[model samples]
Target chain A: MSEFSVELRDVVKKFPTPEGGEVFAVNHVTMQIKNGEFFSMLGPSGCGKTTSLRTIAGFEWPTSGEIYIEGEPMGHRPPYLRPVNTVFQSYALFPHMSVAENVAFGLEMEKTPKQEIKRRVGEALEMVKLTGMERRNPTQLSGGQRQRVALARSLVKRPKVLLLDEPLGALDLKLRKEMQLELKALQQEVGITFVYVTHDQEEALTMSDRIAVMDGGVVLQVGKPVEIYERPNCRFVADFIGETNFLDGEVRAIDGDRVTVYIPRLKDELVGTKASPVRIGEQVVVSLRPEKTRIIENKAKMGNCFSGKVLNIAYIGSDTRVFVDLGGVSLKVWEQNKISTLDPEAYYERGEQVWVVVMPENALVLHLG
Target chain B: MNPHRRSPLVVVSTALVYFFLYMPIVVLFLFAFNSSKTNILFEGFITQVGPTEIVSGNVIQSPCGPFHWFCELAKNVEVRNATRNTLTIALISTLTSTIIGTFAAIALQRYKFKLRTFSEVSLYIPIVIPEIVMGIGILVLFSQLFTLLNSALSLIGDSQLTLGLTTVIVSHIAFSVPFVALVVRARLHGFDQSIEEAAMDLGANELVTFWRVTLPTIMPGVLSGALLAFTLSLDDFVITFFTTGPGASTLPIYVYGLLRRIVTPQVNALSAVWILIIFVAVFLTQRLQSRQAY
Candidate 1:
């Protein structure tokens, strides 16, 4: 058995457009998912995240390149021949089958003994905490219950990799948050590789061990959740993962890993860690997260800091987002409300003069090709 | 005005529409037990009879009795044979058409090929084309096909084939296939294809997936299609008329023959019986299709 549970080698999937031209559903993309790792392919809709998951599940064959599961290359293998199962976004549980029967479907297909199938099905349901819902039909179950049944049905097979294409996309917000943690725990409990595809970045960050953020049929960046959020490699990854401010600037000087960029809007030179290679005089974008920047009344600071006026302040539950306008550039700064009070006068008012302070390490320089 | 409030104009119009729709069927059902053999008038009533035979103008006639036409209908040998033929054709044709149409529907709905659009559009041809035209077309095609087969076989032996009950059944199947395909296709339209993929993803092959997942989910559509096809074949008159040779008369054909030659209460009774049977079958099929919708 290979250390990597699944490996996609430069896989590309194309579909014929109505005009007889081919468009790439999944561009040249490659990633290795470790054994028992919860890997997420996170992107917006039509970004080929689902297509990549389907490729690994053998539902869609790549137009080119290879897929290897546990070191064996899958060549023209059908979905049934592969050792993988998918929990569909719609929870595609068979409406006619009971919850127990749906969970036992895969075992029955393998010609397992009837008693063995029953035991495994029972165990699978218990794993998802759906023990007593055996006799209920999928249609009769609530959305969350049906989602669990889907998970139980797929997990019952105990495949090498479990592919989930936005399994929580159908549930409401409260249930979705609950299921996200449950899914992570379940994946760890089963110790099987989970390849999850979703457009919800928060959901991906909350659940995945590592995430491959994709866009326009290409994998932009792949890293741990913190790495993807804090040190995004490109502009797309930085903006897509979380709320960030992009300030267009030109590279001024380079000092090993640190680079100085001149922002015309701020009329100041800021120094930060260079995320990608850049040359002097090359135009780039400095991505700074709203939560990373501090709001200080005094402009005097050791690191990169700017003086600006408070453009607007939004009171969101626990955090207050302040938009500070530094000349032509507007920077969003989030300050957490540690003191629990619903006093509007206590927070920063609009049009107030506030100093925005961003450390050099927090500002990431992103290069565009 | 609130749209939810009932309008008198709408209610009256809907009532008039139903009246126009069902008035003929109601009259035919009521006239089935009209007591008189002659169906032109309602005049052969025994107004003052004493629970026995009636004498009127030196002519003796049997008194009015309940279910008079139905009893006569059950005893008529021609009508009995026609009913038997109708049931036989309907059952065989419904089975054959439903199976074929289900496969056709799955193929049309699920797969993509060069002529997929062409095939999808063509399914509507049989459903939309005039029934008379379709009947005549099938008659010509079957005749030519049988002639070609018989001539080829006769050279080896003297065996020949003729249009009869088999031909009627074939004709019924030909028309019902598209209808069954339509119903099954409609059901498949809302079907989530991921379940089939899920089945396959769970290590079930295509055949197993179809049997365990796909077919069961679409069973309501298949059953409703079969019921509708059965009713269609049973009530068929024009197609059977064109396709049948001799001794293969279905109920509708027999009823048509009775109506053309003689206007009797027996024809009305037979029509009423056919209508009732068709009504029940159609109502059940509609209920099935509506259930499948949710």
Candidate 2:
């Protein structure tokens, strides 16, 4: 059992649709989660991130391909034999069971002695900081407390891995953030591999050791949280992970990792780092994050810059989102609160000429389609 | 007219229509304690005033008899045996049908297969078909087998074939399985499937998941369905009438036989008792259903 926590080799899951054909829920996807590592599958709804998690939990069986947990091939081995548990999105605590009973259930299944079961249940409850809630049913607990009970239930088993599918998604924003930190700390303290699934980009970014950005039943990229944010490999990944200004283009030149592409929308040539191979004259897409794109009052010659009219602008307290209309398309620039207040009226007005500047290296270009 | 007012004629008509719907049941229930011999008030056309007696707990005897409820019912050995038979058949049918049909419900809920829809539809066939037809069909089939091969068939021939307590129970079970299946099915549908999955993830095999999680959660449904099946079996006359050969008779069938001989005041008393028993049964069933909404 001492092996990588999980390994999925080309797993594909399809669900039967009512009108005849099946929907390819989880397309051919291969991923590995190291032992004791915190990994997350990040995506939009219906993107198969949750399905992948379910397959690992044995709630779903792949149409083809294999799933291995701790080096044992899971060939229709019902969930019970796989030393893994899931904290469901709804916190799926047994509504009829008290918090302590829920936590003690796994131990009781193991036929552990009563004294040890009670002691470990107490320990598990305390681990989640939910002491004295042993007898309270799930309804009596707040959303966060219920989530803790779910965590405690699985954690008491000390499974090889803990799979949490959107565990914090049901909580309010403040509670969600607090639980995110708690989950990370808990994972560290327990030292068990955790495979978390969530559609919240910021949640994945803040909590995961490694994040797999998925779209349309495919994993677009997988890397450390910072790597996914700072160097998104594709347009979908860039758009899904954070705010980005997309520009359609054709590859004008390719020289190793540095490529020059002409963006037809802005009628300009911009330099960007290439993540994948691209042929010359191929229709490609370039993504510049809103924060990376600078707005200057005067023309800047050192970086890629274009002058355009500010079609609209919105002040969001902490940042100003300025929409600069460049004829065929518009680009967004998030000016920090301090920088935005420096010239408030000049940007928020309509039809005001503005300079949209982008650092050459900060722009990310890729062949997403 | 004020706002939200209906016409005066419409209100009067509605009240008259409601009275028509309830007038008979109200009459029967009120006169269950009527102190007069006549089904209605005494033929003298006098409406008695009882600000005292039954309505207030004074010692006035009921109309049908001396509130002789227990001995009134126990005087006839035939009625007593019929009561015993009815209770026996209902209990047996409810227990057997609930166990078998709940397993069937579990299969339908847990697995996916071709021809599942066909099997599901077939489960309701017994319920939709005429009960009288089903009972008579079984009776005819069994009687022919018993006559043609009296010595050859032995397992059920001893008692079930002779149309006594055994035949009644078997017939009841046949008519009840489908209703049990349907209610258990709806309960299974509304069930949160994750309970089974959770059990498995916590180191339970298929059998364990079923025993530990699925069965306990679905118990209320099975129980309520069993009670319904029992009540239906108790009230069934047409089906029991056809299936019973010479000896087997349920309470309703016994009442029918009594009506043929004489509509004894005791029969009315028995009818009131039967209605009272079923009333409690229905009340408890409804309570069970409401408590299981979650």
Identify the candidate with maximal TM-score: 1
Point out the worst 10-residue segment of candidate 2 chain B by lDDT: B42-51
Q: lDDT tens string, model 2, A297-344?
A: 778767588888887889888887888887568888887766534565
Which parts of model 2 have CA positions greater than 4 angstroms off?
A: A1-3, A16-23, A339-348, B1-69, B109-111, B151-160, B285-293
TM-score for chain A, candidates 1 onward in order: 0.97, 0.96
DockQ of candidate 2, scored on C-alphas against the true complex (2 decimals)? 0.54
Error of 2 at B102 (Å): 2.8
The total number of steric clashes, by the backbone 3 Å criterion, in model 2 comes to: 2
For candidate 1, the docking band is medium
lDDT at B188, model 1:
88
Record all residue pairs in model 2 with backbone atoms less than 3 Å apart, i.e. clashing: B34-B63, B35-B63
Q: Estimated TM-score per prediction?
A: 0.90, 0.88
